[model samples]
Target: MLLPQVLPALVVGVAASLMFLGISFLSEEFQVVLWDDLPDALGIGRYSSLWMITMLTATGIAVGLVVWKAPGHSGPDPASEGLGGAPLAPGLVPSLLLASALGLAGGVSLGPENPIIAANIALAYWLGRKAQPSLPGAAWVALASAATIGALFGTPVAAALVLSEALSSQPGRGSLWDRIFAPLVAAGAGALTTQLLAEPSFDIGLPPLSDPGWGDLLAALVIAPAAAVFGLAACYLFPYVHTAFRRLRHPMLMLPLGGLVLGLLGALGGHLTLFKGLEETKELAASVGGWSSGELAKLAVVKLLALLVAASCGFRGGRIFPAVFIGAAFGLLAQALVPEVHPAVAVSSAVLGVLLATTRQGWISLFIGAALAASPSMLALLCVASLPAWLIVTGRPQLELDHEGKALH
Candidate 1:
């Protein structure tokens, strides 16, 4: 009986996943050409400090041009938008898609999540209204957002947890599960679609923690709050950085300027600090022992700053991906500082803290942290550690801004 009502959501979810994967494919192809083929043809090292600076700067200019001349100014300032902001006009989708693809391929410190979600929402809303005028717009928004979240994380559970939080806060008529039934079906279909097509995985292969001990608990208590402070610093600074860029008064000036700063940051932080930080975090984890405490700290600081700048200065992307990198770096730094602390515990706890501050979504943060650690024992530690971290960020300004340019709580 329920299947009849949910059939449309399932179809929409599959379509949304295909759209997300399609954009990702285009971004990867462009990334290879820009960083691999073009550099090879020019006989320049792709990771060379100078070349990274050049490419990032050029990417900024290109994205800026799109924003300045393209429709809808690339779908609003990224700093003012959250992951599931309102849908855009369908006509604005192409420019947003182009900007997002360029930012991803150009090594900006933002993720494909935000722009991709916005694009999907707009498309779904427009098409769904045309097909069924009686279905409320919110239904399309809910299904599209759920599908994208599931596809992004390669799991239906992520969408379920996130939507549970969202739906719990709203005044709805049905039981919570009843309300989310269609979205859950959508999320499941999206997750399966991406799983079959992309096979994305968040586990970075860190050694598992078979034993839980007092020392690990102490490490979580200390490291999680410390990492949360780092994330809070960015949250506090977000509005100011955004204001500074707004002073430039045009995308042509601010975005190119932002790109130049990002290029310099890339040079200082080295190649690891470049891009959205998913693959880079894996590389960091693979050679965790090779880095000194200072090097790990530097990577975290640099990536955090890059994320701040990219999101603030009109770049079309999300902050969550770079926040994950910062968390991993700080976690590794904690282990570097105290040899007794288990790496899995330290990493997950730190990830929990940073994500709590940056994303303000506890379930998603906990899920990402636990996924990376891949240790059953670390779950209790992360849940406990998240309490203090959550308290720190609960009443404070979020990383995003409201309409008047003030920070959102």
Candidate 2:
């Protein structure tokens, strides 16, 4: 019994690791070319403004071409699909991988989570169906989702938190773990594998909150809602952006146009504001002491708009990484203005707000806020902050697209 469950998870871990290998290698090479090798080869100084623009513009064009009339078209607009969706047809796998590779490496402001999830689902499903023809389709989805998420976030907890609702709703469960036991097996293996490979550290480097005061709670209440409002502004603008781009009616045109605009935004915001927020967040955190509140504000706005543009223009990936970056920048801005507030409270509250506003996952948002800020002392404060933030954005539309790839008004 245990062997059957554990063996599949081991397979998932190995497969997911293999996929990450390709993504890391290609993306690293792309970065080195734009920032290092290509600059010297072409006689231009490294990190030149021109190289930056060219890299992004070229990324947009290349991504657009791969996604245009390609075999998979990148397996559907990721904006239309949330973190999880039905698996893809086998034929779509080739194009999905290509699109995913481009999006991950080509400097798009999205992460590898969504496409990776889809790919994992297809692979796991194929294996499960062939071996265990008696199993339900939902099980395959759950298992694949768990394995991939575990691989990406370097923890099974992220997958478990994100999937709690789905698991809880299942009809015949001995316990939540019983239903998710196999996925957890896959998750543990996946997390272990990723950790061995990447050694990722998500600590956003904010000063730890040692003691929380009422002022911290109060600040959280204010900042969290403000962050949510900013997120709401983007939500309102998303449909308009998509509609405007749809006017072009062709990936060849719309995507490249978005790339140009994104490049301009990057020029406006500088290098710190580009790409998925992982490494950049660390850099921003380290430099918060030097930046003006105005600069921080610009970073936040640019990232939010960049996220909208990237998602609207058919870039395929997840928004959480970018949202985390946006929240961190906004939080840094808050701290700059009000030095009295603990960095932990300010940054966590800000993260909680934007993530709640965008994903509407209250628990996950709170967890992320606590995790990224590395402030266990401020967990209660983050919870307090998350309440009002969740209330403010509860009924509003989310940062996702509908079946027809149109944003909800």
Candidate 3:
């Protein structure tokens, strides 16, 4: 009985770890190749409206080629794919990775990091099955899945926490080795890749934080429930949006529709809301001192709307990047209201919004929030704010999709 339980976990975890290692190398290689070769080879220049349009057009064409040629690769919006919480098809890994890379690199306003992580896990399971056809199955696949997730997000703790919560959410379940082993191996591999590639660290600049006063804490208390409301709404709306788009059923039409909607939103919100959040978020954090609380609030609303539309359409990626973007906007707004606290503290606090909207596990949310903040003071605030966020989210409706692409009843 013990052997049956443990063996699957070990095999899945190790396989996931190896796959994580390989994906990290590939991710770096893809980035370098695009930077060095794409610019010179394709003559794409400094990103501008014209350049972005060109890039978007190219991405659509590329997506068209792939979707037409490789049918198995096409799936639901990957940002919400995790909401499915089911094992992925092994053959889908390569195409998923390629599509994500193309989407991210070609300026289609998608992030590949999460998809890469998921793909690595799928690849791990495929390899393991080939090597050990007799390996017993358990929740080890979930563990391995967590390991790959940890590698991408730069925090194994968060990845592990998510896996544990996912398992516990199912009740009457126990720990799976796959969850622990793969993430450990993948995180190790990812760290090695990060060091060797000298990848730029994610730096969100916020001023030093002061201790949270009663008022700040109270505001956080209110914000937690508000954030949970948004998270639940997102979980509810995403599937409908996806279903509506699928009814159109044409990749060519679907992608351009995404581009048009995104571009229109960008025009309304300014181009800052258009692409991935990295550059714009850093810029926003730096300028938090200049904006009024109300203006910052508007940015948050717009970002939330934009991200919802982006995910609902046929976009091929994750919401975490845009969630950070939306959270940072809220932080800046809150800073405008609470000038007494550090801007970093405000950013850190607003991040609860992202966590609440995304997961039931408070620690996982806090970990991601603190990772984005990258400061000891911010981490402390994250722990405090996460409490109420967790409580509010504890009973929110879940977004569960089954293996057959149907919502679980």
**Best model per TM-score:** 1
**Candidate closer to the true structure by lDDT (higher is better), 2 or 3:** 2
Question: What lDDT tens digits, residue by residue, belong to model 1 across residues 177-222?
Answer: 8878888898899999999999998888798999888888888989
Q: Candidate 3, TM-score vs. the true structure?
A: 0.78
TM-score of every model? 0.98, 0.95, 0.78
How many residue pairs in model 3 have overlapping backbones? 7
Comparison by TM-score, 1 against 2, better one: 1
RMSD (Cα, Å) of candidate 1?
1.0
- In candidate 1, how many clashes are counted? 0
lDDT of 2 by residue, 345-393 (tens): 8778898899988777776787788888776777888877878888899
Task: For each candidate in turn, give its C-alpha RMSD to the true structure in angstroms.
Answer: 1.0, 1.8, 4.5
Tens-digit lDDT track for model 3 on 214-273? Answer: 765666665555655665676666567667766777777666666566555554566566
How close to the true structure is residue 107 of candidate 3, measured as C-alpha lDDT?
46
Q: Tell me the spans in candidate 1 whose CA falls farther than 4 Å from its real position.
A: none
TM-score of 1: 0.98
